[model samples]
Structure formats: C-alpha cells, structure tokens
Target: MNKYLELALLFAFVLAETVGMWRIFSKCGRKGWLAAIPMLRRYQMGLCAGRDAEGRQLALLESGVAVGIFSCIFFKTGSVSYMVAAFLLLLLIIPYTIFSIRVYFGLCDAFGRNRFWVVPWVLCDWLCALIWGFGSDFKTAEGYPFDDEDAAPEVSGIEADLTAPGLSINITRRTAMSLFKRKVLLRDIHLIIPMGHMVLLLGGSGSGKTTFLNAVTGYEKANAVITLGDSNVYKEYNSMKYDIGFVPQQDLVRGSDTVYRTLSDAASLRLPADMKSDKRRERINEVLDTFGLTPVKSSLVDKLSGGQRKRLSIAMEYISDPTLFILDEPDSGLDGVMARALFEKLRVIANSGKIVIVITHTPDRVADLFDDVVVIAKDAKRTGRLAYYGSVYDARIFFGKKSMEEILMSVNRREEGGEGRADEFVRKYSALAAGGEV
Candidate 1:
C-alpha cells in the first residue's frame, strides 16, 4: 500500500471503531458523547454492564477468561520461542486442531449459523489473528465458510408476518425430572391469544412479560408446544416462517429516514408483492391517522418528539396488518394523556378483530382499557417469575375499590395485619393468577 493510503486506512479504521462503539452506547439508552472519552467509556461500561443485553458484564467475564489463557502462552514465547512455535504448529496442524476448529466455528457464528458460536470464537480468536492478519479482509479469507452453509434464510420472510392465524401454545414439564430448571425466563408459560382479542400484561420492571412476547415470536426457547391454530409454530419456523410483527422496547428506527419514506420502504419490503403503491400509501396514511400522527408524516424520526416517535413505532408494526400486534413496554416514556391515546389506538385495533397485547404497569386509567391483564413480580434479588395471570375485571371485582389513601397505604407500607405486604401482594396476584383473573 502507498504510504498515504496506509495512513488513511489507519485513520478510517480508528474512525469506524469509534463510531461503531459510540452507536452501541446510544443504543443502550445513553448519550453518544461518552464513547469519545476513554475513561468515560470504561466508567459507562461498568454502569451499563448489569442492564445491558445478557448483562454485558458477563461478556467481559467471558472475554477475561479467554484472555487469561491466551496471555500465559503469548508472553512466555520469548523464553520458549522454539517450544511455543512447535506447540502452535501441533495445535494448528494436529488431528482436528483446536485452532482450525474454532476458526470454523467463528465462521459459522459470523453467518449466524448456531448459538454456540461464541464457544469457538473465544477459544480461537488468537488463531484467527494468525490466520487473518490485522490488515486482511475477513470476508475474503480463503478459509471463509460460505460454501459450507447450504442455505441462508431469506430476508423477505424474516421481516413479515402472516394474517389472522389462530395459535395455541402449551407448556408441560412431562414429569418431575423435567421440573429441574423448568422455571424459564419467558417461553415456558401457557397463554392463548385468540384472534381479535386484546390483552394487557403488567409487571414491575420484569415479570417475564418480555419473555412471553419473545415466546410468541419463537425468540425464546420452550419445551412447550407453541401452536399457531392447530399447527406447531416451531415446526413451521423450521420449514416456513409466519409473518409476525414486533415493536421492541426501544425505537430502533433508522433515524435518518423521513417518516413517509421509512414507512414506505418498510411496507414495500414487508408487504406482499401484489400490493400496489396506492394501497401502500393509503395504508400508511390510515395507520398514521389512527395514531394521530398524520400531521408529522414527513418528519424525520430524530425530529419527532418522544411521544410522536413512539406512535410511529406502533404504526409501523401494524402497517402490514399483522395477525398479532406485539409491543414491549410501548408505555415506556409516555405520559398520562399520551398513554391513554396510545391505548385507544390499541383498542381500535382490537375492535377491528386483530389480537393486540400491551405489556404495562397497571395504569390507573388504562386498567379499564384492558380486556385482559397479566402481572409479573420479582423476588428480593430482582429475579422475576409470573406472579399472576387472569382477567383484570374479575381481579378488580374481587379486590373491590379502595380509597386513594388505602391504595397509597398498600403502595407505601406493609399490611397492618402483621403479614408482609409484599408477600400479600404476591398472594393476591398469585390468587388472581390461580383463579384466571387479572
């Protein structure tokens, strides 16, 4: 490479690394400025570790564990240079070498081949360093395994959801030995979402609400049977995927695109090929109007208010008219009026005979808005399990209306009856769940 090009290449790499990691921070609900400062990145990393995906701290621990063994071999290379080289040769060349094996696994992971790819990547990162030099293009490596993968998932099907399909999901332990670790994060539970019905799920922080949402889409695993009507969802996904719609907790919208273009492109990609541009535009306008966001139809996502942005997210998910509209914490940053308005939109969708589910915190007014509700609570350690699952109306009927002060008392203090209020809440919720009342 030319001297100037090398310098440019180095600068480009540095800039890319900086921007990529900065975007990662912003994605975690933090400002991007922290990524520019080295000390701040470390500090934020620690602060964000516990709350990040799969707890980023665990990622650090795994990387730390891998580096420990790698360092032991690396630094000792000077004193045992020949021995080190010999060992390297043996490891890389011997029968089913760990290096080659891990490299292969990393390739599998890069292409999203399997879940256990991390096992190979951590063990073989050093070997990969030797195989593909720092300056080399990883995508063009001679050992790249694209040819090994028989087929790749089609992007078209992955992003779309089919029309109203009845689903029946069943979770069973089979026996007691299966009971070991039967307590799952989300997918093991049994819930039936009939067509055209709406449900509101409530939890404080976590209650496996998110997990249950993931279960619907098959992101989370379960020994249980997830049936779409009488057909098994898992078996369908293995052979052919359903057109499911999801709006995750955060607005992962491409901030650059204007609302019009964003929805247009999304619809074009997700909708059926036979769908025309006129119908697409009409559908977009109808969705935008449904959420009272028609006025800002041309605004860039970054230019919208928090409330406007949230409405847009909901609108986008239902643009294709999905059978099930699933949203995670759609109420996350909305206020009383905005939350109420959003619920009304969900209500409209529900009344139209589509299934709508909202994961919420038992909003004072929205309680009446919900046709059904499920509550999830956590133990002292923040470990969550479903505390209740049932009909909201019945739970209210059983508990009866309490004065504002009485409600506050329950919220603020334990029971005057000498029992733990938190425990009482657990029992009340558990009873509601056991009785099939929210």
Candidate 2:
C-alpha cells in the first residue's frame, strides 16, 4: 500500500473517531466540545460510560504509556539507569493495559453493549464509537446486591410496636391533555417507609415532590398503589384516611383562637362523635404535649413564635392519633435555629413510631436530621423523575457529594444546558428495582 494512502486513511479514521465521540458526549448529557480535547476526551469518554472510576483508569493508562515512551527514548543513550526505569515503566504498563481492558468491558456492560465490541473499540475504534454513540442508550449500570450478612444489627432502644404498618407507595403519572402519551413522573416507586424513620423528600422546583406527597395523601389522582399493613389504600382509603395526616406548608391554625382551642376545634371536626368530651380534650392535650406546645397551649395562635406556629400546624394533624404524617416544608419561613428545632421535633415524632415524610426546599443544614431521603430530578423531557432513593449516607456516596445541597448543585450544573440525565437515573433505578438489587 502507498504511504500517502495509509496517511489519508489514518486521517479519515481520526476524523470519524472525533465525530463519533462528539455525538456520544452530547448523548451522555455532557458538553460535546469536550470530545475535541486531547486528554479531556478520554475523561469525557469515561464519564459517558457511567462511572468516574473508568475515566480515572483511562487517564492513568495514558500517563503510564507517556512515561514509558519517554523512558524508552532515554534508554537509547545506553544508560543503565534509563534501562531500569524503562523496565519498571514496562511493568506498570502491563497491569495498566490489563486494567484498561477490564474497564473497557465494564463500560460496555454499563452501556448495554456487547463485550466483543471491545475489538472494534481497540482496532477500528471509530466504528465502535459510532455504534455506541448512535445505538446505545446512556443509562447507569445495574447495582450489585447488598450483602446483609455482613451488615451490622440495629441497636437502637426505641422499638416500634406499630399500630399502623409501614406504607408502600407506587405511582405512574401522565398529563390530562395527553392521556394516550404517558410521560411517567414517578415509575415503580417502591419504598418501605417504616414506622420510625423521618423521610426527607427532595427535588428541585417542578420536580414533582409536592405532587408525590399529594398523591400519597390521596389528594392527587394517578395510577397508584398504596398499602398499609394488610389494607390496600385504593380499596380502604375511607378507613385508612384516619391513620394518615397531612400538614400543609401554610399555617392553618385560627389566628384568633388559642393553641388549645385550635386543637380542640380540630379534634371536634376529625375525631369520632362517639368519643366523650373529656376523651377529646385528653387527646388534644396529648397532641399538644407530644409537639412540646404545652407551655404555649394558652397563647393565641397569632402570638406564637414561628417555630411554635409550625408545630401547631403539625399538632392539628395529630388530633386523631394518626399513625403516618406527611409534612410539606415544615421549616419554611423560619430561621436556621428554628428550622433545626422543627426538624428535631419531627425526629422525635418519627421516633414515637409514626412514619413521617417531610418535604423541604432548604435542607442543607438539616439534611442530617432525616433518617432517610427520596431524591428526584427533572428528565430531558422536563418531567420529574426519581434520581436516588435510599439512606442519606448512601445518597451522599451515590452522588459523590458531601451534602444534599452540593448534590443539588452538581445536578443543576449538569443540567445547566438542559441536558439533564435524570431519565438515565430513573431507568437505572428501575432496572435495579426490577432485579431486586437496590
């Protein structure tokens, strides 16, 4: 073959590879310009493959190869030291090459591609990139099963003798205008909200956090399945509604009425008529005591502090001895100290054997106050979708951020140009849930 022909073919392949990578980066919710850079392209490729470890490994390989080539050039001087350095570099290169191959295979698995595609990725790499960029869907890889045998046992002294068993909620959402075209906001959301955990529902504006809470409370319509102990929410909602309570963000107490009177009125409205007046009064006092409003029980609702007002709202919902509580932005319009105090109150409420779900927009300082979290993000089509749902500690690790605020910032930064990868997160979680691995 002619040398010029070989050179021309090399140029063509390089161009194809560049174009392929550009498309792939764009598809993976990253900036396409990253593919045009030299070392950045490899890093971007690793990110597209759905794991930072892959990108780091690729970068290490490139560094190792560069060092080895430099050592080889120096060895031509016939220096013993250069030869030793080259030998060591060669040793490093061998393991790096093997690891790089493993990373490549892992990338293939993550992208749902054939393992043998590594061949084209290594030889005619442009063809592999083209196939992956165009044909493969950018989604996260399946997670491995959690080994409970190696897990630590719970030692908390507070045990729940649950009167209301934990609830499992599932919802599939669609718009009224497009009934035939179902754009799922929440998909197969299976959460076992136990009796003694404060769950924080998190998402950006328009991420459907409010909608989810409303659906769980049976205020919003959807294809939903909610189970409480042996009862189906759909079939037994009239009876089950007594077991649940919802506290809206806005204060609901009558400003002119005293705290005690407000709760008394609420109890009268919600409690059964068969209950004696003394029993209703006893229940109101108990709720006021539970929320730590006994001292301010005689104060007018308008005169209560902001935190006290919030607690009053919660206390109103507790009139019927509800076993499950859902609060929307309980910390809104409060200072940091009051917010923390409110969260502490919620923690105590959860510890009392009630399944508590709190929704808040400003939770950075109070992220640690919740026992668990349900995180959602907006997809490419601007539909709300679940991003992560698990323990707060695990969520930090999953998002690679130290705090929920940082995680939200990272997500926002990723979606700055409207290339949100929330759909990918949902797809991955769905696959994991179906396989019973998450």
Candidate 3:
C-alpha cells in the first residue's frame, strides 16, 4: 500500500472514532469536546460505562506508555535501551489491555449490547466507536450507575449531650470533584465520643474511614462541626491543634536519632513554646516512662525492635498529652502478642480521660479494649454513611453478628461476598436515630 494512502486511511479512522466518541459523550451528559483529548476521553468513556476506577488506571497507563514510546524514539542516545523499552512496554501493555477490555465491556453493558461487541472493539475500536457513536439505535440503556443523585436523604442519629465534656463531630457532607463532577465522599455523620473512651473506626475499602478521621481532626476540613472540649477544631485550629494528636499508620521517626532525642524534638514542637526548657525535658521523660521507652531512650531508633519503635511513635504523639488522640493502625506489622500489648497501652491512655480513636484492621484481637465501634459503609450512591455507632455489644446485636469482622461482612456489598445490606442498614439506623432508639 502507498504510504500516503495508508496515512489518509489512518486519518479517516481517527476522525470517525473521535466523532463517534463525541456523540457518545454527549449522550451521557458529558461535554462532547472531551473526546478530543486523549487521556480525558478515556476517563470520560470509562465514566459513561460505570468503570471510572479502571478508566483512571487506564488513563495513567496510557500516558506512561506514550511517554515511554516517545522517549525511546527521540531519546535513543540516552541510557534507555530499546530492549529495555520493549520489555517495559510489554509490562504496561498487559494491564492496559485488561483495563481497556473492562472499559469496553462496561460500555457494552451501558449500551445494552452483547459481550460479543468487545471483539470488534478490540480489533477495530475506531469503527466500533463510529458505529456506537452515530447509530441512532445505540442509546444509553440505563442511567450511569455512579451518576450523582438529586439529593441525599437526611441522616439522624443519637446526639450526645452538648453540655458533656467529649469530642463531638457533626459532618454535613464532605465532597470532592471528579471529572468535573461533584462527588460526596461522606455525608450526615454525627456522633459524640465521651472522654476516656477508646472507639474503633471500622469500614471497608473506599468507605471513607480515613476521610471521617481527617474531618474529626480538622486536617481536611469539611462542612462539619467538630469540637474537642469546647475548642472548635476548624475555627480555632491553631490553638486546638495542640489538643489533638494524630499518629499515622507509618511511623515518621528518624533512624539516626535516639529515642530520647526523638521525644525531645517532639516535645519542642508539640508542647507550647513559652514553657521552660527544663519543663519540656521533664515532660519528655514522663512520656518516655509512660510508654516504657525509658529503657531504650539512649538507643537509636534504627536499633529498636518493632514493638519499641511502635511505642516510640505513640510516645512522640503522647508528648502533647492531647485530650483527643487518633491513631491509624497503631499496631500494624506487629505480632498478635505485641498488638495486644499495644492495645493495652492505648486502653490505659483512654482510662486517663482522653478520647482515643483508632483504626485497626485486626480489631477483634483487642475488642475488649474498645468502648465503642463506629461503622461506616458506602450507600447505593457510594457515599460513606454511618451504619452504626454504639457500644461493641450493641453493635453485635444490631447487626446480628457475633464478631466485628462478621459485622463488617454483613454491611459490605454482595459482590464483595457479603450480604450487600449497606443501604438497608443505613436506612434502618437512620430510622432508629430519628426515633431516639439508639
């Protein structure tokens, strides 16, 4: 075939596909111009097919592959060998193909077409897109599964006594923008955790567990009212920050520093600056003894054992002596015995009149240590909704599950191998809250 003829044919194919996709995008309530952009077009197509997650992965992979190929062609004089480039391309193509197939199948489902349509899509996607894009018979069979709802129903729950001293969180809604559309990550989460209580935060993947904690800590401010003993976390973040201690899952300690020096540095930052140097040192020593790090105070962080490192992480946060302490997977990577011992230490902290909230995947190991459990689940619209918030004993009874893990399974989606009762439980809890039965 003549090179010019081949180029003309390719141009026609590309134009036809772009036109088809533009129409398809319009049909799905998306801007038709999106189809003109390479990466955004893939993502929008995925959104239309209800496979936005895969679409995101595909878009990123496509960009990486494009850059790799471009570099191999133009930067051959660089260190990137053609052999290495070909191998890397193979690695990327495998997953790219998988994600592309998934998006195509999703599109088929959206258009009420059979699975066989994927063959044409895989072999001749340009022609396939043109047909689907321009064919009057091709119309969206059902609304996009993830389309934003007109309004989310009000959520009601047992409100704690405002006069009481505790950590209170009243989140109206936490939203984010995705593909130029507003998405609610969490909504209508209200609860009060009394001081001297250890509460377990539970949720499955993408259920907004981390988001709720961020809202409570005022790290990621949401449209919510969060108070820690009369201090507004959002409004008075500067002053209230010292009253809240958040220990992330990964320890942020330097290996070169000794345990005592680590605590001393933390004290300098966490404690008020006006305090005398001797007073700060004394407080650091106190925290060292409290977390049983006194023996290892002189040792470098790299030399300490896992349990000791974990304790040091907690001690750094405890140096602030905050009224509200939040830890995400404080016992991660520890053995059963170490986890139990760590939870015991946390239990003691809660007993000392501090509101302690923790997120642990292995909650049952220390179930007895927690005073309450806060369960969050994704509703039909995929917004995180409060399914239950009460004592662990009551949680078991409410979900008719004997263990925390079982309760989690009960609320997870059926595709996730559970009962798919998240919406049901959300509604039931809302009703119970409205009736003041919780």
Candidate 4:
C-alpha cells in the first residue's frame, strides 16, 4: 500500500478510537480533555468506578497485553491470523461501542459500562487492541447539551399533564416544624401544582423549598397537613408516601452493584413475584431510554458521572409507576437547559394522570408548563398555612413582582421574623439588663 493509504488507515483507526472514547467520556459526565490521553483516561475511569479500581486495572492490563500480542501475531503470520485478531478486537470493541451509545446517547452520560462488569471490558479491549492492531481511529468522550424530550422515550407510558390547570401543592409551616426540632425552617406553604405542569420552587439559603417537599412527602413529620388532589396528604401520610415517588437531593443508590443488577434487584424486592424478567426489562428500557442509560446499562453504579448519576437517580423512582412524583431541587446545580429538560421530564410524568412536583429556587422560563400555582409565606407558621393556590399560568397575576424563589425567601424571612419576634424580644430584654447592646 502507498504511504498515504497507510496514513489514512491509521487515521481512521484513531478516529474510531476517538469516537469510542468520546462516547465513554460523554456518558461519564466528565471533561473531554481526559479522553485524549489513553493511560490517563484509564485511571480517570477508575476514579469514576469507585470500588472497582483493581478489577478495572486488571481488565486494562490484560486487554493491553492482548492487543500487543495480537499486533505481534499480525507481524509474524502475515496470513489469516489477522481475522482472528480482528474478532478478538471486536470482543473488546463491541462493548466500547455499546458503552459509547448507551452512556452518551441513552443515559445521556458516559458512565455506562457495556458488559457484565468493567473488569471484563477492560480485559477484552486490551486483548483486542494487542492482537488486531487494526489501528481503527475509534474514539470516546463526547457530550450533548442535556435533553429530556429529545432523549429516547423510556416510558411513552408516562404522559405530561397538559390538560386544564388544576394542579396545586400546599406545603405548610407547622409542616416545616414537623421536619426538625428547635424551630421550624420555613412555615407551611402550599403549591397548586396543576395536573401536568413543571413548577420550580425558588429560594435562597434557608428559604425552605426542600423542607416543604419533605413535609409534602412525609419524609419529615409536620404539625399540619400537605395537600394534593385537594385532600390533606398529611392526614393520609402512609398512603401518600406511596403516591409521591421522591428523588432526594443526595445519591440514594447503594454502591457495589452494576446499574442493571441494582435496578433488577430493586425490581425483584419491590416488584410483584409474578413479574417476568423480559417484561420488567421492557419497563427498565423505557426508563433507561428516557434517561439515556441504555449505553452504560451494564456499567457499575459507582462509575456514573454527576449528571449521569443524577439522571439514574431520577430513573430509579419512576419504575413503580407513581401517581404524583416529587423531585426536590432537581435543578440545583444544573444549567438552564438541563433544568428545562428536567421540567419536561416531569411534565411527561404528570401527563399520565399522576402529578409531578418539582421544588426549586426559581420557576422562570417554564411558566407555560404549570397547571396551577401555590405560594407559601417565609414563616414556617405562615408559609405552611397553604397560602395562594391557583392556576400556574395565572401565577403572574397572583404573585406579582416576586419570583418563585423570592416568594419563598420572603416567607422564610417572615417565619424567622415571627420566631424572632416571639423570642428575640426576651433576648433583648436580657441583654439590656446585663448592660449589653440591645
């Protein structure tokens, strides 16, 4: 072959390698820079792998050795051993491809490992690369802006509630009091979350949006009630908990299991005994596709990136088909687009007759997605009082000049102010008696 042709072939190998690497990195929720360096990327993959470090390392070493041997065989035989090496290379390549597709495309992140485990993948790839030396330009590490609607439709089962706005949620202060002792964080507050709407709860610091959801979910004990479907949820605490599927602000997935294994185990424990694996998988596929987890379906749970982990966490809650799903601070650290997509995802969930409630610090740019609006005062006592409950589309008219976050803050301040008024006056008197500043 001519020199140019050899160069082109090598370039193609590198291209495929690059694309493959991009795919993995993309799903990992990591920076693109790491995928450029092979060895370094391996270590980075380990970091994301959590406890799988040794297994991952061995896989890489074995695969590396295999690829090296494969190359040497090609140099020596010059015959049809090339095909055998190619097949071996694919043993590794196939998983990488799957990872690329699932992590980057399906799960919307790069953490998806495409096999029974990462260790095997590492070994398989090393063997393939050593033997074939095809030098195909496969690459990994890619990214796309976070998307919800555009992602594979996991459910097609859950629909967004777009009917007339009657959705409202009320989280109240005594509700806040029910959360922790000492003093209430923010008073009770109510939100009229329309049937198929995406509402953002905005607040700064101790504004209490999260606290509100806890009360709503019965995660915390409350002196008062939270209402959904116009019924006092607190009154039906045990039953209501099941009605609302929650994705907490923190990672709740137990470490030490692959994504599929963990979810499957959960299905086994939580699902009915008669559920078949195939049918269960079909539902799992819907969620995986919706959340873009199909790529790293076989990946270790600990290997997922922040974004991928977040998406996976969200996916875990919906498998049971909840009626009202509540997400606390779903957009906490996310950018605008992901936040919007989060809303879209919730919208899709709500449309299925189940209500979707998302609490955040701001509810801007998604006004059209809301069916109802509920605002709480800053005081745990006042805010938790189930203040304004109306159509979210009309929120502009109801809560004028105040953003959702600002309203939460104001209510929080009012609650704190009330508590301050109740006790601080005594504190001031004591300070004055002791000749300190009033």
Candidate 5:
C-alpha cells in the first residue's frame, strides 16, 4: 500500500476501535470518553466487568502489552542487550495475554453473556466491542435481577386497595352510511371484564381494535350500550369519566418537562379538587417509586429511552388510580424484553384490583402474562367482530390453535372465505355472556 493509503487505513481502524469501545463503555454505564484515551479504556472496561478491582488488574496487563511492544521495537536495533531485555518483557507479556483473555470473558459474563463471546473478543475485537456496547442490557450497580419473592418486596409500599365493582360490557357498533344504510363494526360484545384482570386485545390492521377501544372510552361516534356494573357507559360519561383512564398509542406528555414534573402536572389536573397539595406530592412520589421512575425522575420526557417513555406515559394515568385503565399499543416501539417487562408491570397493577387492557398487534410473547384475551376479527365488510374471548390457553383450544398469531390468521382466512370458522366459534362461545368462566 502507498504511505498515505496506509495512514488512512490505520486512522480508520483506530477510529472504529475507539468508537466501538466507547459504545461498550457507555452501555456499561461508564463514561464513553474513556475509550478515547490511550490506556484508560482498559481500566474502564475492568470497571464495567465488576468494579475497580478488575479494572486495576486489566490496566496492569495493558501496561505489560505496551512494554512488550516497546521492547520488541528496541530489539529491532540489532543490540544483544536489547534482545535479552525483549525476551524478559515477552515473558511478562505471556501472562498479560492470558489475563487479557480472562478479562474479556469477565466483561461478557458481567453483562449476562456466555463464554461463547471469547472467540469474537479475541479474534474480532472490533465486532465484539460493537456487540457488547449496542446489544447488551447493562443494569446499574444497584440494579439486580430479583427472584419472584424479592420482586414483591421491591414493590411493597406501592400497592393500592382499589375496590371497584366488576364490569360486564355489551356494545353494538354500526356505521352511519345513511339513516337507512348501516354496517355493523362490532356485533353485540357481551363479555364480562372483571375488575383486577390483565386483558389483551388482539387484532390485525383495520380490524377495529382501536375502534373498540375508542368506543369503550366514549371517544368514537357510535351507537353502543357499554355498562360498567349497572351504569350505562354512554349515559353516564360525565359521572364515569373519572373511573376510567385511557393511554393513547402516542405519548401525550410535553417533551420539555422532566418525568417528575410531567407526572406532577397530571396528578394536579386529574386528582380530586378537595385533595391537598401535600397529599398530591406524596402520591406523586409513590407513583414515581412504584414504576421505577425515581432514578430518572429528573430526566426530560424527550430524553428518555423508548421503554422509559412508555412507562412514563402509563405512569401519567396510573397516578389517578383509575378502576379501568386502557392502553393502546403500549408495546408498539419496544423490544421483546421491554415489552415483556411492561406487561409484567401491568400484570401487577391488575393484580392490585383494577382492569387493565392492552390493545396490541404483537401479543404472542406476552400472551401468557395476560389473564384473558379478546380477539376482534374483521369480516368481508370491514367489520370487527368478536372471534374469541377467554383465557389465553382456552382461547387457543377454543380456536384449535397454538398461538395468538395462528388464531388471528385462522380468523382472517375464515373472513376471506376459507371457512366460516370465526362465525361458528362466536356462535358456540356465546354462552360466555351468561356467566361462563372463560
């Protein structure tokens, strides 16, 4: 290669190495700038592996590598003494090399990765660094994965004694094509959604999943009779509005406000007017700690990660402690782990005596977390009708399917004329309206 070309390639390689290491450091909750330094990056990597102890040892090994390389350069000068000194330095380098391998494996293990990472860490350091930084989920020093028992202790004080009557919904939707021309969207939904249950609402695009949510929240223009206990939903919107909380698909928070500030504002606006400011402030603190937002309470809404933002949005409504909480596509932008965590939190909230409904398209992985699932399938006329309503396992058996996705595909195929399966399932399961425990 030409001299200039060699320099360019060297510079590019160094840049990639620096950036990759920097990202790893950042993900490990260390300052990324350490990667830009000559030897300090190794020390930071040690800190990431556990704490300062490992870092100190790694730094010493890095020093050995440096000394060995310098000694080799001196040995090239054709001096016997320099060659002997180089041999002594090479001996130190041998142990340093071994420890370096151990340190790399330690880094992977600390971040919940297996020893399989050793090959990439040794042979393809750049790729290893990139994956470590961008792919791993690093917990903070204080954050530890808790067992089910410990998890309960972590959320001890945040539990609420919410006692609301169970809800049984019966709604009918029809389009206003004309006073005479009408098409039904939802055909008489008469399912009982009990208080304190986590429900999953599954549907495909244009399947009226969102439409059903709006109807329940009294947002859509529809002719429907929805009853929570003995009260008609539409007839009692003014009195029942406080009993419900709806989190739309998109966050409705101001990006400029911190998490604490946004939630405080929500509580102030939504809480009872007779409530004192001190009580509101104390409740805000409870909400923050309940949802694991205490650490990021000062973080601006726009600056939070997608998962944090979603939690914050839910927290905004959770501050009210509504009896019925409906979240539309809360898992839309999150990864599988984040989506699962979000649903797990919702499951806890449901267990505390409130109705929590999540409308989502991707419900397969987290389906087990929900107590019941309501599937809405659209027909040839673009109407969303109930295809199945039952426990996750029973819904599978009721539809003769293994997965939510499989059941949805079967419903759509039926709608598209393969079979009248959806209609038949709805007919057979109509007894759910008459106290059937699905």
Candidate 6:
C-alpha cells in the first residue's frame, strides 16, 4: 500500500514481463532483443502468435497512444485540458484493447494453450509470459497452423498457351511488403482464357481479385508471364495498354462535360496519337453507338441517370476498342434490370470476339451471360490461389454449389459462415491442372 512498495512492484512486473517476452521471442525464432523495444515488442509478439495483420495494426495503435500520452504530459502546463486528454486516451484504448486481446488469443493458440489462458494474459500478462516463457512444460507446438512454409501448392497447373489468341496470365507469385516483412498477395495463378469468352472473376473480400486484374492489365506487374493476343503485357505495356479496356467501378467523367465531349476527350487519349481527327471522331461515334450513348451524346454527364453514367464510363474506355475488356463492378449501384442490360452489352462485346472479364457482387443475377468463371480463394496464409477456372456449369459441379454466390460461400473461410475449403479446392484444382482427375 506504500508508494515505494507500489513502485517496487511495478518495476518487478515490468522486468518479469520483459524477460518472459524475450524468451518467448527466442522460442518463436525471433531475436530476443525485439522484446525490449516498445512498439516492436508488440509487433513481434503478434508474429509469434501468427496474427501478423493484427500485430502490425496493434503496433501502430500503440505508437499513436504513446505519442498522445507524451504530448499530454508535455503540454500539461499549456491550455491542453486533462479531460480532453482522458477522452482521447479512452477512444484509442477501446480499439487497442480489442486488438491486443486478439493478439493475446493468438499467442495462446501458438503456445498450445486454451482460450482460458487469455484471461491471465490480459489481467496479469507479466506472470503469464514468465510461465509460458520459462516453464519446462511450455513450448511452441509443432505443426503450427499459421506456418506458411508449405502455404502454396506445388501444382503449377496447365502451362500457359502463349500461341493461343487470348489473355494468358501465369503469375508465379505477387508479393508486397507488410511491416518490414514480405507478404504474398497471390501465388501460382496460371490460366489461359481463350478469345471471345466472357469470364467472371469471382472472389470474396481480400482474395486479391483487384490485384490479379492489375497484374493482367500490366498496371502492377507481378513475377510472371502475361500474354495478350501474342503480345507480352509486361514487356509491351505501351502498345498493349490500348488493347486492354478497363472500366473501373467509379465514373471519372466531369459533370460539366457532355457525353459527346467526354467520349471525344477519351478518344484523344485512348486512340492512336497518329490518328487523324476525322478518323478519331468516327471511332468515337462507333463507341457511342456501341454503349447506347448516341441518344444522350449532347446530355451533360451530371444530368445522366445512374445507368447512363455507367454506360458513358464504359464508352470512354471502349473508345480504345480494346481486344481484352475488363470491368470492376461495372453494374455497381445499378438496379437488376439495368445490371442485366449492362451485362448484355458485355456479352455483345464478347460475341464480337473480345475477351471479357468481369467482377460483380451479384454474379448470379446475370450468370447465364458469362461463358467461363475464374474463382480465386485465399489459402490459410491469406494468399490468393486459383480455386477453379472453367465453364459456369462445371464450376457448379466442381464446388458442388448451385449458384455463383454459393460457390463463393463454399471457398470462404468458416468464420465467414461458409465452408472453409479454400485449401481443399486449391489442391483439387492443382491436381486437375496436372492432368489428374479431381
């Protein structure tokens, strides 16, 4: 109860926790010194428990909170009120507690402890760390679930048909940095889509759908070969850029510009630099008619309806008359009838021999329009892997689901309220790609 005794107890607790964390880090194959650092210690602990994502976030929150506390102390003599500092600290602590609890639970899992261990880890973390760190019985479990060494399947799938006249993507792996560590976004995605087929790019949240598209379009080059109609996309992005039409979810047209002017401006940017004005105008008119914007050519973009605005956006991209067309949620914010009509237009483009790939949340609404489907799923390590790539009917049979939405559910994680068969499907598809039966 004495102030000196309280100080002594606090110092001892800190020393015990630090020593325990250091030992835990060493056991987890990390440097023991990491436990001594303020923010880095929290992050390293997250990694030890296989919750790297939450760990990185927790480190950031901890850093922010420390900075806020320091500022409050430094400015105590200034106009800064204690009540404001208290409220600010409370706001940060709520989320901080949530993230810390998750990391603690992950630590419990890593050390082969039950959820009940989280209670002591939260209330008396120093003691828990000492017990788990130095106890003879406490050791990291073998075959940890979050181990990523064998995360990717060895199945390379079918070889890309470079001679085939369509979009061919053979991404070995797409990686990016996360908290100073390399993280894989996608891996072992190899498939060749033939010309004139409308392919649906299906994946749940964080499944790398957009990243795959960016790789295909050469916007973000991955470590793989991508061929589009006999041209290497990464090697010949300058020329291939014109041949790939990408309609993003949001329209970028100006409100003051009329539909005709919008297309004309797009034509100037998308069309060949050497093209004559007359020829460019002719091509713009064709695109205007193709997307059904001819009637509203003189209408201001702001005055256009949702469907009309969406069409204009497509027309702007279509002004290039690309051989490979890709749309990210082209029907977003449109009603059922409008979405169906939009997909019908895409079908027409495919009918004209252009490769069409689309990503839509409501794929079942226009399932009949797509010729093939490319399903991507995140494996246990959270890296996107190819789950299925074939006809729509075949996808139904492969996933054993009746609809596209159901197929998505089948590959989603169990926590997402669906079958957690992503790794299963990835292996099956790999075997199928190697000329073996699933």
**Full-model lDDT for every candidate:** 0.54, 0.71, 0.85, 0.53, 0.72, 0.88
Select the stronger candidate by lDDT from 4 and 6: 6
| Candidate 6 segments whose C-alpha is farther than 4 A from its true place | 1-15, 22-40, 48-50, 57-128, 131-158
* Candidate 3 structure quality by residue, lDDT tens digits, 192-263: 899999999998878899999998989898988888887888999988888889998898899999999989
TM-score of each: 0.54, 0.58, 0.78, 0.48, 0.58, 0.80
lDDT of 6 at 274: 95
lDDT of 2 by residue, 147-213 (tens): 1122111111112222346877655553433311344554434556776889988877777788787
Give the clashing pairs for model 5: none
Error of 4 at 210 (Å): 3.0
The RMSD (Cα, Å) of candidate 3 is 6.0
Total backbone collisions for each predicted model: 11, 0, 0, 107, 0, 0
- Model 5 scores worst on lDDT over the 10 consecutive residues at 147-156
lDDT of 1 at 10: 49
Model 2 clashing residue pairs (backbone): none
The stretch of ten residues in a row with the least summed lDDT in candidate 3 is: 143-152
Q: Tens digits of per-residue lDDT for model 6 on 235-303? A: 999889999999997987799999999899888888889999889988988888888889999999999
Candidate with maximal lDDT: 6
Model 1 earns a TM-score of 0.54
lDDT of 5 by residue, 1-438 (tens): 354575576566657778888987777667999898857877777667653445666676667766665565545455887777687787776776665677776676666667787777877676667666666454323341111011101111111112335666656554645222254676556567888889999877777888888788776646666667667668888777777888889977899999999999899878998999899999999988878899999988999988889889999998989888999999989999889888898889999999999998788989888999998766544467776777998988888889888877776644354343454455445544344553
Which pairs of residues collide in model 3?
Answer: none
- Model 4 C-alpha lDDT versus the unseen true structure: 0.53
Residue pairs with backbone overlap in model 6: none
State the lDDT at 108 in candidate 1: 42
